[model samples]
Target: MGSRICVFLRRAGWTMWLAVLMLGPAQFANAASPDPSLVAKINAATFEVVIPRADNDPLSYEKPLPLDLLPYQERTDKYFSVGTAFAIGHNHYVTAGHVLLAAVGDLTGAPALRDANGHVYAIDKVEKFSLQQDFVMFSLKEQPQGNAALATDTKAALNSVVYAVGNALGTGVVIRDGLYTSDTPEDENGRWKWMRFSAAASPGNSGGPLLDQNGKVIGVVLMKSPNENLNYALPIGVVLGAPDNMAVMDKRITYQLDVMEDTQTSTFKAQFPLPVSYADFSAAYMKLLYAQGDEQLKKLLQQQGNDLFPHGAGSNHILHDTPELSLFPELIVRNRSGQWSYTGRELNRVPLSGNGYVASGYVGHNFLIHLRRPDDMKVATFYNDPKQMMDLILKTGYWTREVGPEKIKITSLGNPASSTTYTDNWLRHWKVFVWSLPYINGQMEVFALPVPDGLAIMMRMNSSMGTHDSLADMKALTDFFNVDYGGTLAQWKEFLADSSLLPEVLRDAHIGFDYGKHFSYDAGNISFDYPSTLQPIAPDNMLFMGVGYYQDHGKFALQPGVIQVRLNSTDPDRISAKRHIAPSPDLDDNFKEAWGKLLHKQHPYDGVPYNDGDEMDVASVIDPPASDAPAELYTAFYGTQGTHKPEAMKAKLKLLTQQFKLKTH
Candidate 1:
């Protein structure tokens, strides 16, 4: 009973009502074919204009804004249904002007037409358009087979029976019967007449052909009116009679679409989060790496071809990347034809909404992603380090993870000569370091490559969430890129030196130790000093010596372990009194009974007993040992669990043992 006119934007899940009244008898001699035959022929020429969308955009669920003054809404998808357009001339399609304007926001790709045969063709250019009258004509890149006829006798009597044909609810072309109610002036001036009809025209039905009882096209459906049983269509006579309307178009129409430049490029599609094809990959890559008008990047893309992406996702839904975190933003290939091999199998996956096919192709175990925003360069730099970069990327919300350093074969490019001294050169020039840890989800390895223009590639091992360990496969990938960089160490260094985004300092702050920076642990009764930086934990029932910072991936720390120096006040547990204790004793015994093993083989200094055991030796000291009273010191060293290896633990234990001493206050 109440009515409000709404523009069609392809919203799904709404029922439409249609009304048609028998036209007042106005017999015309030129009425053509039977309704059924004409309807069949017209329907074949109709097609659905579809725009490719990401899985995340809710194209079909959008609703009209309740108010007019609200801020304009934007969608992330490339295209959704605009009011339907039909082929009117060879390779020419026409649609409501408003519909085309609303659908092609910041166009990333051209709108495509899917005909009754399900074949798609790209819209090339606007041939005609008029904002005042609401109509647009465009040419298609691909030739269409047929076109619909425009009525010669444009006038329709009141109450004429008519049929509406269009893509309703994006399902397909549907023909609905309704009544031609009356004629009304288009604007306040009444310069032209608009045909009013009761044929149900729902969202996605605008710009379709309106026909008479004998199936001759009469008008173009444009919009629903705010009155019951009233819909408006531009008269066919108005469209066909005005020659100037055919050339009317807005000259400033621009789109942001990513499409193939030519026919030579083939396409390859995989599951979601993966590129649809070679063309899709190239288009996305070129968009991020090049500025809006960079011709050099375009040339490189055309010349490089598949060489740019030598690796492909195979059968596996999961793609394992190189163990190092550098291949993410960009891959630097030494040879133009370099390719990658991965261990994964392709499998069929059901298509998601909007996109129907989950095509099978190369699925890798890792994701080498590259992302950039045009506004990122506006800031000095988005992040200071790889950890900061990762934090910024995952900033959709706040989250954290623990990490630690791991050693791997590091090389720049494919040069073996530069590989001879890879470790030092890599750490200095590339800022290449590996941080690994057991994340909240699973094991992960992070590799960061400092690229130009605030760009970086973060390669990680076993990065895919919810997937089991793929370290073995990741190692193979890492080895491939390690030797893939074609440039020498000097050339790489020069590039980093010249890049605006690379930090001035390249040394990693989390690895190695300066043994000259001594530290002391004073426990009132017993105290000593070690050569390296070791912090002190309060002496408990057993005195504990804390060394280096070890937290959340061991950032800003090196060779972390504890030096426990226990004061066994009882003589029976003292090492000086028990020289006959077994040379090789139990390691699990408390510090009181473990003194023999802690000091088993060294010479004494002055009167104090000392033994720098093979497993335990001297560390360092900033100051001489000091105490308030004579204290019997029994020491044991232990490394933290997990990646803490025994050989590394033994080295630290020897340093602590030799540095262990008891002083009289």
Candidate 2:
């Protein structure tokens, strides 16, 4: 008989071996609770398998290394190996495809397994795996005498408590309990559906058995939540239903880049090959305009035509006929005081269609352009012209769609004042000269075009992997990303010790900017936390979540769903909670207190002032806010209060200046 059968016999308990045959219905009724003897028997049957490296001896090359190294033989041992397996029938066992991933090496290579007693057995045959589920089964070369094998069953109660027995963190067998939470339906990826539970798991727990009350396996422990106690398991039914061939597992392991094509006009996304900075963007626009040969036109307008010149063939005749001409002059002109301007001049004799005209405007040190159409003077392009030279500005200024804190409005120019006889002649020829002034330095045109799906992924990558100039801040970003991705806690500590990924540009920008300074959590989605920044922008789909660098911070370039959670809680009033891991005590305290006060109502606290360091247990009392509330309410409550207010408004100005320290000067 196989060892698996022997293990089953031990679990059945010699005294009750006959009872299992007699009490079939009774056993089924109490399937939610496992027999203590069976639980222990299952635990004992689980073994920690360690494979050792071959020594560098001449004889070693001629022969294969032994299957198992003795505990006393330290020299031959290499890296620690730990995985869990359970008896299926006699000596046969089942495990995850990933567990045997490294062991199997190339196809057709035999894997050797060792029993707890140090006995070695060759893998006789292996069955294929459930590609979607990542599971596999193999039989041992020899079967143990006198043991029965446990069969898998798909019937499991929803919310029923289940136990997972596995080798956790390379330690011996341990069991954890949780309710069967959910089964995700087959998605575009494949037919596999994950079985979710609340059981806590660690690194070495993969491939272990998630068991029902009767000690029957329900699923294989696969992965666990990095931030919480949730765990995921692969359903055992997938393994039971899999075909004989295992080649499918090979294809499933390979990563495939799938670009999803979006058909919605309102939901298009585009990706650029490289990241463009504000300076680069500005330079590109300037270059595009310069290439258009507007410099010569600009010089001609600067001449300022004189009326003393005589008409053709008459020395005494004053030059009264100003040619009706509209000149598009693109030049960077600075007055004596170092102010730049954009000049568009039309010289015309008639009011509507003039003889000589000049339209001139200034764009400060930076260039600006005013595009006009005859029908509607109200709709025109103003500010720095992005299309004139480099196409730096993504879209027409008039095409702005303001949302959130962005403010966009069009103001008409006052009627032109009548010019004196001498100046009138200069202006008559300038019939439809339009000019737009640059309003703000930080402003940039947002195109109506869609943000590409790939852009979000790229942004995530930048936020997680990009190098920052500040060593301390770079380490923090790296630590956050690594830990946020399920990397070991030790890996987070190691990231702090290494600063090779820090970039030079970021370091230079940090010198005078107090790179280490950080902001409050509720101060919008953008935060300045030293060597790194966090920009959490709600994407086009208000419900869709993403991160971006809207200001001076870096961008996120990782994919969504890479680390997604439902974020569900029983407390109805605690709709959402954002936690920031800060470095200093004072900063952490301030944020915690502020956030706490904002979320919950404070009591008198025995008239001891809210600042007294007394702890209050608010977790149970504060319920989550209703989900139907407007998202903007939360965003506004979190971001800077006066962002939407115009800078010139006195009340808003005072509020921003006094409360947020905004400087208009």
Q: Estimate, for each residue in 122-209, the C-alpha lDDT of model 1 and write its tens digit.
A: 7776555555566666777777665553333477767878877665554455667788988888653576888888887765567777
Model 1, residue 314: C-alpha shift (Å) = 66
Worst 10 residues of 2 by lDDT: 16-25
TM-score of each: 0.33, 0.31
How many angstroms is residue 337 displaced in model 2 relative to the true structure, after the best TM-score fit?
Answer: 37
How far in Å is the alpha carbon of 480 misplaced in model 2? 33
Against the true structure, whose lDDT is highest?
1
Candidate 1 — which residues are off by over 4 angstroms? 1-34, 54-80, 89-92, 103-106, 146-152, 187-189, 226-229, 245-665
Clash count for each candidate, listed in order shown:
54, 77
Error of 2 at 268 (Å): 28
Q: Model 2: runs farther than 4 Å from truth? A: 1-33, 57-82, 106-110, 145-148, 250-665
